[model samples]
Target: MEVQYRSQFPVCSFRLTFAVCVCVRACARAQVCAGAECWSVHSNHTSQPSVCGHDDDAFKYCAYTITYMLLFPIAILSNTGALVVFFWKCWHRSSAFSVVMMNLALSDACFSLTLPLRLAYYFNRGIWYFPDWLCRACVYGFYLNLYTSIFFLTVLSMLRWVAVMQPLRPQVEPVRMARVCVGVWLFVGVASVPFLLNGVTQR
Candidate 1:
């Protein structure tokens, strides 16, 4: 009777193990089928190109393309004209106001130069095909110009305020105004280094 009981125990254990293996395989197949179905549905539903997990819809692409196209030429021509006029008429002036205006025009012109790259990026639907270094340089120039413009504009406003309030203060020396412009440019350049480096390093 004991021998018979031991034999039956082995059979029961074997049956239990077989049942678990079968159940696991069945569950795995079901999961595979479900995953395949979900993937098929997702692929079918999404037709637009994606960038960084976000869909680049046609409307968004068109909007940016139109905006960049319109702004690119306008910015380049106007800023170029302004810079030309500033150098032609105001470059020899030594007043703080003139210095600020010159720097502002310079900054705007530099920013405008980067707009063609931006236009190309948007035209390509947000994909950057340019060399990584060029892209970084363009981006750095854009940001540097932006901050420099802001800084110089603020300084210009303050200078105007002082001129209006004092009404009789001696004119700012050309050398001093030149130093201020240099300092502002240096500050902007130093501040932009990290951003430029990070952009270059990123994937």
Candidate 2:
């Protein structure tokens, strides 16, 4: 039983990670909790920010602000550098795996670009100065990237296994992997459309 549990650990961890991606893509707000009430102030409105959720929920916002602040720079910068390195490395090579990684890094970089808007929303104390469409886009992009990166990583892992199993197998065509990555982007993009329809609401 112990050995079985140990062997299953990786599967459990993957499931947990996938679950988190689904949840985040559905809501896209780290500060917002399930069934929690939330609202943002319009720039033109002369009203105070509306706080939602329990008293301790304020801590959630604080935590998100700090986390996003720290993550923004690191994710954005690292992913940017990775895209460059991966592109050049994969260039002139039939490394399908590296192509997948380029897409993964690209997805991360795209999402990281949206962090400033999110940070600004939090910085204003929940007052939203951006247009409603922009808000929806940010949330949409967050989830889209979330799922895309997961699928890419999964594909990369499977490819790694194939590489290990048949070390003599010729490298997969980069074009083929690019097609797979495109399919992932399209599938996740279509699935993410529903996220634009909902968000944390105000009282």
Candidate 3:
């Protein structure tokens, strides 16, 4: 009985080892097959952003082509139309309300100008195609618009309150309104100075 038991133990161990080895090889082969399938799917798909993960040359080209040829032009045209209308109609007006609205429009214009660089970045497959300084300048310009919009909106609200509660009080002159608008813009610009100084490159 002892001899039979000892012989059975070795056989059991051998079977266990064989099963483990087979499972490991099957898992490895499954992984390889899955990787190949992914590569094939990527190769067939034309417009995915290859920069985020895959490194195929064909995928990169398709991604750039779609981004530059399709999206960038639309953004530029829309923003340009906005700027033209704002300058022609809004900027020439004199009321405190119009003044704040103009500042908001101008902030939007400045913000829109920064999109071309982003378009270029996507066109270049997540790469920085422009100079390092331009990248920094673009980001700084974008953030400046944020602060400008906020400041101008605050001014607008204050002006609204004064108009409602104190309409009987003497109205602000056009010249003074112009000065307040200019001062608001300048103050917002000054507040954004830190972003400009931070060096807008890479990030």
After superposition on all CA atoms, how large is the RMSD of candidate 1?
28.5
| TM-score of predicted structure 3 | 0.54
- RMSD per candidate (Å) reads 28.5, 12.6, 25.8
Model 2's number of clashes is: 1
lDDT, model 1, position 46:
69
Q: Model 3, residue 83: what's the lDDT? A: 52
Q: What residue runs in model 3 are displaced by over 4 Å at the alpha carbon?
A: 1-93, 123-125, 200-203
Clashes of 1: 0
| Candidate 1 structure quality by residue, lDDT tens digits, 1-203 | 12111100000111232354455455545554342323323546865543323233554565556655666676667666766665665556545666667777778777767877877887787788888988889989978887887788788777766666765767677669778999999999999997678654443
What is the lDDT, from 0 to 100, of the residue 61 in candidate 1?
A: 61
Q: For each candidate in the order shown, give its overall lDDT on alpha carbons.
A: 0.65, 0.72, 0.57
CA RMSD (A), model 3 = 25.8
Give one digit per residue, the lDDT tens place, for model 3 in 1-203: 12111100000111232354455455545554353333333556764432224334544444444543553455456546655654565447645555556556667666666766765776566678677767768877876776766776677677766767776666566567668778877777777677666653453
Point out the higher-scoring one by lDDT: 1 or 2: 2
Please give each candidate's TM-score: 0.67, 0.69, 0.54
Q: Which candidate is the best by lDDT?
A: 2
Lowest-scoring 10 consecutive residues by lDDT in candidate 3? 5-14
Those runs of model 2 whose alpha carbons end farther than 4 Å from true positions after fitting are: 1-54, 199-203
